[model samples]
Target chain A: MRLYFEKRKTASKKTLVIVPAVSLVISLILTGFLLLAFGVSPLQTFAAMFRGAFGSSRNFAETLVKAVPLMLTGLGVSIAFRLRFWNIGAEGQLVLGGVAATWTALFASPYIPSFLLLPAVLLSGALAGAAWAGVPALLKTRLQVDETLTTLMLNYVAILIAEGLFYGAWRDPGGMGFPGTARFPQAAWLPRLYGRVHYGLIFALILAVVLWFFIYRTKWGFELHMIGKNRTAAHYLGVNIKRTILISILISGAFSGLAGATEVAGLARRLQEGLIQGYGYTAIIVAWMAQLNPFASLLAAVLMAALLVGGDQVQMMMRLPAAVGLVMQGMILFPLLAGSLFSEYRLRVSQPHKEETS
Target chain B: MILLVQSVIAITIRAGTSLVYATIGEIYTERSGILNLGLEGMMLMGAVTAFAVAFHTGSLVLSLLIAMGMGMVLSAVHAFLCITMRANQVVSGLSITLFGTGMASFLGQRLGPAENNFYLVGLTAARFRRIAVPFLSDIPILGALFYQDILTYGMYILIPLAWFYMFKTKHGLNLRSVGESPQTADAMGISVTKIRYLYTILGGMFVSLGGAHLSLSYTPGWTENITGGRGWIVIALVIFSMWNPARAIYGALLFGGINAIQFRLQIAGAAIPAPVLNMFPYLATIAVLVLVTWWESKGKKRLGAPAALAVSYMREDK
Candidate 1:
């Protein structure tokens, strides 16, 4: 018998939901084996993970804290991915945003009023992210350079630039050679929810709703979707493909920048080493897992955040490396991608015909 | 001054070896229409596995072989997802990278310097040593290139053979045709799937060789992020070289020079911050990417990218 994949006439809605759920289950089973190899009982490990992520109010709050930046970046990535614009430089853009916000907090806050400080920092951060993203967008549209490679390259450059500033110009005088900038003034801090969770959570939720509406309801959203589906067709329909792509990427970059700004203002309180993290890369998986839906990305981000938090728990409890979470995260994508295939195509087994009967 | 120049050139050759292998591998893979961003992860895995094996057994050849095997195995996952399942190449490649890196980090934790000095010492001992050519070592300026490890010398031979194979052979013609227009090639009775799977796996093995070279020769010890951003640099180098293996050698040396200059500057206590100096290679990569793309767009000559570089091909799909 020969096996082949046959494309479906129409996608099954049931399969749309079932595929991811099945994939997640399969991934868990696979990771359970990995945990076994690491000399930990999979059940106990998973139980610990659950407890670590949601055991107490404080644990849940910390999860949300991690989720906040993830939500914003995931939403940002979803928007760009929807338009088929591979803006992999969100990490860099986020760093630039943090730098911009830090600049505003350090130099501009002393002169500005308390109310204006927050807005100025946020705006500057978003603008900085947009500007950094604009480089790749311009290159892609004007010169036809591949945005993926440029964006990826820019991520390294951005991190290095941030490092340069932290080690040179922005190094805190009282830090005694520490590789970080001075802490921001009190005026620049984002208001906290319960003395731990920052206001970034509220912004992320609001942005999710706004982004959903923008993508599903607006005329420009239709154009962006059209462009993603077929650029030549969109161009034929006079959708102003270049303008839409440029704007979508800029908006995407802005959200990621806002994530960076919020990270510093709400949590870090300074431009320090290890400021960027791999949240930008994680958001790529989040966006893909959520199928590029803004609202779904909120849930996906939370789930990913739990995985990370739980990963740390596993490190402490099982004496396993924290990279297990990253491994699990990567494992989830593989199954998810593989499972997605079944949504569009079905496997068929065919028997060979008998030559004598013919 | 001449001594400094000589040392810098020697350092450049040392640093460029891994990149040369990675670029050549990627060029071959891209020529067959598969873009594997998992090179970074593959390199990392290769490095860790090589270091671990060499540390335990003190067999350099065994370590290199095992690393190559691991690379091929990891890339097979990529090939299955992108080619067989028709998943997005970029996402598949990235997933491979993340998975590989995470796995390597988890496995190599115990092999780090702080955790085990004995293993590190073993790795250092098993590392490839440089060999000086008798007459070539006496020559000025050009002498440094001849004084390299066995792998570098092997590369010196491999690069020419690769170029000839790609530009002169019938199989190379088939591979290029498969990448440029798979449907046309398929119509001509070529198995697109076979060619892609073969070249991608082969390319992945070469990438692992690059990684093995890193742990077994260049640094001669296990460290977190030992490859640093060299994998990304290799990707940029592939484009700068216009997907030509011979051209890739020059690009690798140029980037290697940039890397060596930063170290020299730091040693000389230049006024610039070390981080700023570290940014030179990445910045140069970006600049080169833009310049090459812009040059290709402006010139009458088209970029040498395969027409179906990242597209998935299914025989039954029109």
Candidate 2:
């Protein structure tokens, strides 16, 4: 018997829900083997990870803190993805956001009113992110540059720009040689609702709702979906592909930029070494795991954040590498991508054909 | 000025060795209709694995083999997902990078001697040393190619052979046909799946070798991120070369020359900051990409890339 595939009449909506869940379980199992090979017990390690992430209010709050950036960046990425634009520079965009936020909080705070300090810092960051993303969009639309390379290359450049400032121009003089900017003013500080968790959670949640409406309930959302599914069709139908790509991508960058703003204004309190903890990269996993749905991505962000927070916990508690959590996070996508086939095609065991005769 | 120019040329060749390998590897993979963005991750894994094994075993050949094996295994996963599973090629490539990067970082942390706190960072290992060709080393500028490690010498032959294999051979035609139109290739009695799978895995071996060169020859040690975006730069070089192995050397020279100049300027204490100077290569790549893309657009069609690239062939689609 030979195996063959037939396209499904309509893509299975259920698979969209089921595949991610199944992929999670498969990842856990796969990671178990890895854990065992390293002389660690999978069950106990997983229990430790769970406890580290959600064992107490404090740990869960920290998870939420990590989840905030992931969610915002995930939302940012989904918008570009909606138009089939591969904007992998969210990491760079987020870093640039943090950089711009630092500038606004430090230099612009003197010029702006006290109450507007936070708004200005956050807005500048979002705009910086939007501007950075606009480069590749213009390149792709105007010069036809393949975005994947440009976006990926810009990430390194963005990280370097941040390094140049904190290590050089913006160095905290009083801090005695630490590579970081000075702490922000009190007005620039993000007010916290609970232990170490700031209003960024609220920003991300509100944006998630607003983005859901913008994506699903508006005429522009229809254009985005049409452009994503069939760009030729969208173009033939006069959807103005170039303009939509530029605007949507800029908005996407703004969301991720705002994520960086919240991160700096809330958690780091200054641009520093640990500010870029790969949440931008994790957001891609979050966006895909959520099937590019804004609502689902917020939830997916939490799950991924738990892995990162829990990974750190294990590093402290079990002396296991913190990268194990990353390993688990990356592992989830393999099975998910492979399993996506079932949602679009049906497998059949075809009878072997008789050898052709002359 | 003569001495400085000669030194710069020497550094260019040294640095270009790794880029040439990676560019050719990516060229081969994309030529067969597959785009693998996992080169950075693979390079990191290769560098780490090569360093760790050589540190322990003191066997260069063995370590290099294992590292290439690691790359093949990862690329095979990408192949299976994109080819058989028919997943989104872009997403599948991205995931491979993610997974490879994580695993490499994990291994770098876990696969070291306990004396160094089980970290590959800061440990010394066996590395390739430069071997100078006697008469050739006396030449003014061309001598740069003679004072090189075994890996760099390999690039000299690999570049021409790769160009010839892809453009002048029937198998190369089959490979291009598979990438340009898998359906037509299938009708022409070529197994598109086999060509794609073979080249992808084969290309991955060279990519790993490029990483191995970094640790074994250039830097000679393992850091958290040893590739430092060289893997990404290789992607741009593929475009700069217009997907031809022979033309890749000049792009490598341009980038590798930047590194030499950057190093020299830093030693001379130039007014520009190190970070700012380092941004040139990336910026230059973006500039080159725009130029090449614009130039390609002015033409009718078939600039160099396979027409059906990144599009999976199911045979039933037509």
Number of the top lDDT candidate: 2
lDDT of 1 by residue, B124-147 (tens): 547899999999977887789889
Please report, in order, the local distance difference test score of every candidate based on alpha carbons. Answer: 0.86, 0.88
| Candidate 2 residue pairs in backbone clash | none
Residue A113, model 2: Cα distance from true site in angstroms: 0.9
Chain B TM (all candidates): 0.91, 0.94
Cα RMSD for candidate 1?
Answer: 2.6
What lDDT tens digits, residue by residue, belong to model 1 across residues A224-245? 8899989899999989888888
TM-score of each: 0.95, 0.95
Clashes in each model (backbone N, CA, C under 3 Å)? Answer: 0, 0
In terms of lDDT, the poorest run of 10 residues in model 2 chain A is A349-358
Please state the error at residue B105 of candidate 1 in Å. Answer: 0.9
Per-residue lDDT tens digits of candidate 2, residues A56-150?
99999999989999999999999998888988889999999999999999888899999999999999999999998999999998887888778
| DockQ leader | 1
- Candidate 1: residue A356 lDDT (0-100): 29
